[model samples]
Target chain A: MVDRHLFGLGLRKPHYGAFLDGAEPVPVDFVEVISENFMVEGGRPLDVLRRVRARHPVALHGVSMSIGSADGIDVDYLRRLRALVDAVEPLFVSDHLSWSRIGGFNAHDLLPLPYTGDALAVVCANIDRAQEALGRTMLVENPSSYIHLPGEMPEWEFLDMICRRTGCALLLDVNNIIVSASNHGFDATAYLAGIPAARVRQIHLAGHSQGRALLIDTHDRPVPPSVWSLYAAALERFGPVATMIERDDDIPPLAELLDELALARDIASDRERRAA
Target chain B: MTLRALQHGFRDWLTSESGPLAGRYPAGLAVYLNTYRAQLMACLSDSYPMLVAWLGEAAFAAAAATHIDGSPPHGWTLDAYALDFPVTLDGLYPEDPEVAELARLECGLGLAFVGPDAAAVDPSRLGNVDWEAAALHLAPTFRLLPATTNAAAIWSALAAGERPPPAERLPQAASIAIWRQGFTPLFRTLEAEEGEALALIRAGHGFGALCAALVERLGEEHGPARAGAFLGRWLGDGLIVDVN
Candidate 1:
């Protein structure tokens, strides 16, 4: 049965001033930030974050941690991220189980990591170092994949092993699961079943674009019905996780996002009611 | 392949045509290359809007492709990626000073918009201080730029949704002053005298030296007055943060 669940929306720059204006009431539990956006020394972004934090809980979701890079995490990047963490006091901080930078050059995409044993060990070590440096455990989100490498293990096993080894929590993005499952020919339900229920701390729901060969995890559209179904399965497995809708590009109005978030809330609430 | 090799292969494939996507994952490879290109190009466009206006979308994208090839982003944040793009554009169009100047103006705006917030300079406390002993501190967001073309006007017009004036080069060397005033970032051309004085101040020149320099430029009678006028302007512009 679902116990306690929270709904949130990913905060983007376009809606910053609106969120601060306080004219309309938003119906989400907290706002998740891209983390790097507010990693400035002092500016309007930080000021807005401070004002927003005063109003709602914040979750620092980062894109550039590169936690799976074999070259290791950038020390200065970690210190700056930690500084932002100290300042924001987010409910929790998280990044993908993918790497962005390699060999001193950063591609800035949530680039895939081969799900090999060595890659798993590297990411787990990096996560451990990151948590130690930040003085707190961080949740690692499962990223949408485009291709499966030759010799890598299953994505779910990679996630399970990383969380188990590093003591990190799972973000368990359901949309990513559906997107990857469609792209790589796997069952989204089986992917969820492989994950340990107690380890999930949050759930990310978003939309994907249908490509000719694969589904692209572009968080531009509303959550599709198929992803919503997978999210229900996730809720059944990892009950009552903190859930948020993530939209990065072609952002709709705050009201539109709130409506999508309400659907997630309704789905979860119904699941809970049925259990009751 | 090892994770390191796979990632290295990923980066190589992204920046080049015939890199490591040779035997595997061609479908996914195109998606990532498209993403990296789109992301970095959007950042450059944001930082250099006037360049886009001058060079249309297709031409701008082509030129930006060269810049992107020359300098991949090395920072954690894309905010700072366009910092060196003006130079890259300068090299791309050495004969067209307007390109680099417009990129510089746009980049300056981005910097001023995100730079540290500071308390506005207090003008009333100027009376009790000794002029020569006080070294003025410039605001954290304040920047001085030497302009070669009417790029500032182009940027201003683009900002105000008006048609650009003309792309003319200046006969005399002029500098543009950019800083964040309240929440708005602004830039304006500086008179030679004001620019010189700001240069001296930026170089840690004291008030006495500034006054003497103004005296040498103007007559003795109007020199200190002009210096005080500059002081008033700096304070009013929120350009100075401290006096030491």
Candidate 2:
């Protein structure tokens, strides 16, 4: 089980110096470190990460493990990733539930999965393997997809099956659910309703940019109001999961992000308080 | 499709120029793949800005597209995607040593940024070692590049997002040292003699062997004194690590 933090924000390089200086620690209860950014040797990123870890709890979010790929997990990558986890001792570790590689080549993007029975088995096995390697429970985040595969079951059913089989927790990104559902013409509420409340461990709130007809999870802008409303709906259903705001590009000042995160914290708290 | 077949099909769609895979995917899937390619190219362009500016966006984009097609990212992290970019660019820009050298330096910086962190040994620990006989172990993030052009200057300027002046006639030979001292990555252009000494030391040559290489390269007339002075400066600069 993960700690119930009211809100967290994705750590970025722009805020590294301020974080080291202990300038603004009030806005977030925790921060999410992109695992690869600080994996490198003796540098500012690592130094800042150490400082941040000292001040607040961190969660390591990784992009590359390609857990759903048929070619098997990259052992070398895992070793490095494990070494990082040891160094940071994050609150929890997580990766996308999609594959980013095939036949030794990486697309560097979270490629969509076919969502078939075979993919389910492969993903569950990979999650089991990853948890065993890390010696800890892992959370699998739902990826924002612009494309759907032919064999994929409904996204929610897939997540349900994966968590049921592997005992891994889910990091449900509300924005992703909304975006993918809108793109695919599925009911976002139905998608949210399908996720087992007991299995959800974390929540991600990020802004998405619109492509010609679909929403792209660019993480460059502020969290859209519609997504925020959907998050409220998720809280009503899932009951105040650990939520974080992820802004990766055109990032605003730390205060601005915290303002956004504070809103989430308030929303989650209000819902929890109401339930009580 | 079987998992393997599905993977192969996806790989083909991502890499090859063919559009038939577009038909295979569900409606609107092709748009996603195209968007994926564009976003990836944007990232590659941002990461290798100097290289892109030097090669011009069109040519650089073509090269990046080719590189992506040839070696799609395997890790979720894009930080290490262009690790072999310099070698590939070297093949493409054989006559432009500046381009190749700049790519190497840029890649080195990127690697230092993302490579595994090692605790830097405090210089105070070196007081116990015999400086004259000790072989130096450069930090795990240390990288040395010998180049035939003024690429280091160009790279540094580009890193600062400054436009470099036109390459004034290429230099005979030069070298650059890149390493993470503390948490900040530092790069410096090294003289031929300094580069050779550091190279020998990195190759596990003892202090005596480094002097020998310096003497062999620069001759005895001024080699010993120059090498000794350079070693002192390197130690002060935090460039040399005590291996013993």
Candidate 3:
């Protein structure tokens, strides 16, 4: 979500050597890293991240922010993340639209939140606290949920309300929409249509698996045709957002991911052609 | 339900099976349970890879399950989940002392790998210091752990992808020193006297008192020489960060 069309990949361990070599660039406009992985006191992890930042623009994506915690936000977490943000000066800083911590116990997974007015207030307040502490706006990604708690609004309405209330942005995950739509029996297109397109600054494309009775967001494989199709739809709506292919497990070589990013470029090119 | 009550319901479902959330959302609850346990187990496996290799997968998995059942994660980060695993290993293998010792060594090395960064004092700068009054400040990452078995040797072998030796106790008391050097985590065994000396320094004892203790143990002739030798080793190892 810089001012131009952009494509990238989630930096993982398997491709560290390729990305850090610095002889030839990894063909990414920017590389997104899990902020917590590099948020250490000091060591090779931070050293490698600094080296990579020197090569390409970076994005700080987090998993444990727990923005919708009913109890409150963790100020300690915000302080550490702020330090990393200042160091990297990344293009975008993001976490999921979910809560993981409550009453001193951290679930460590993105737990679902009801889209009721109360939950909306909690998320907005937490996001406000985070943005103020970070001294910059943050993007909150839509999470793929398995269970739907009793709520008054849909997930898109909730996201729109959050951006309006906190002056934040959005990192729309295409695969999460596909998975959640299929799991909860909602319309994916309708879900996309409801989001505020102007506020979406980034897009996450990944793969999922079929659970016994629901779809799970297991980012362990290549992006599927369904996800690609949804990505095309999302691009059409959100217009050339910063898109990336995220493969967390069973990570292929750097070459394979680049080929995937190339496909994203092709898709975006195709969209622009139609617009013309 | 109120958001607080709803979260507590989710917590009960994850920590224990007896909760209203489970009955209402059986299929979804199953998915979460599996993911929670699997992620915690994977964390233990990652943090203690050597221990997993030493204990083999099945035994390590069982021990991890017990720990997860009793210790719900409290820290915001998953790395803290590995902190209490060594204690769990102790309870599970009371007679097999090597198992827990190996876990302790691995965990300590992991901590030092990301501990605070400090620049070791240059050896050439030692001549200007007033030795009697100087308090030798060790590296912030420096950690001394008790050792009753040959866990350090076992760790080395496993890291090199070689077959580890049978677990055995040492003839005398010992400890292991873990710290980082130039972005690499390093460890070495410490003799009983050296371990006591380092512990004293860590507890804020000055170099003069350390020499006096050494002199009291070994006669006046060798005591000062031994103290000087210890200082040289510590300096050479990049363990002493400052002297004041």
lDDT tens per residue, model 2, A212-256? 778778889999998999899988877756789999889999899
Instruction: Fill in the DockQ of model 2.
Output: 0.54
* Model 1 lDDT tens row, B1-244: 6778888888888777555676577788778888899999998887787779877888889888998888887887888788988888888888889878888888887888778888776778777877778889888888899977888888778767798887888888889999887767878798778998999998988888999998998889999999999988888888888886
Clashes of each: 1, 14, 0
Worst 10 residues of 2 chain A by lDDT: A18-27
Q: After TM-score superposition, what is the CA distance of residue A109 in candidate 3 from its true location, in Å?
A: 0.4
TM-score for each prediction?
0.96, 0.90, 0.98
Off by over 4 Å in 2: A2-5, B17-20, B25-27, B53-59, B69-71, B74-76, B114-132, B156-165, B168-171, B213-223
Give the winner by TM-score: 1 or 3.
3
Can you tell me which runs of candidate 3 are displaced by over 4 Å? none
**Of the candidates shown, which would achieve the greatest lDDT relative to the real structure?**
3
DockQ of each: 0.70, 0.54, 0.78
What DockQ would candidate 1 receive versus the native complex? 0.70
Q: Which of candidates 1 and 2 reaches a greater lDDT?
A: 1
Candidate 1 accuracy as lDDT? 0.86
Residue A123 lDDT (model 2):
92
Which of the two, 1 or 3, has more DockQ? 3
What C-alpha lDDT, on a 0 to 100 scale, does residue B138 get in candidate 2? 73
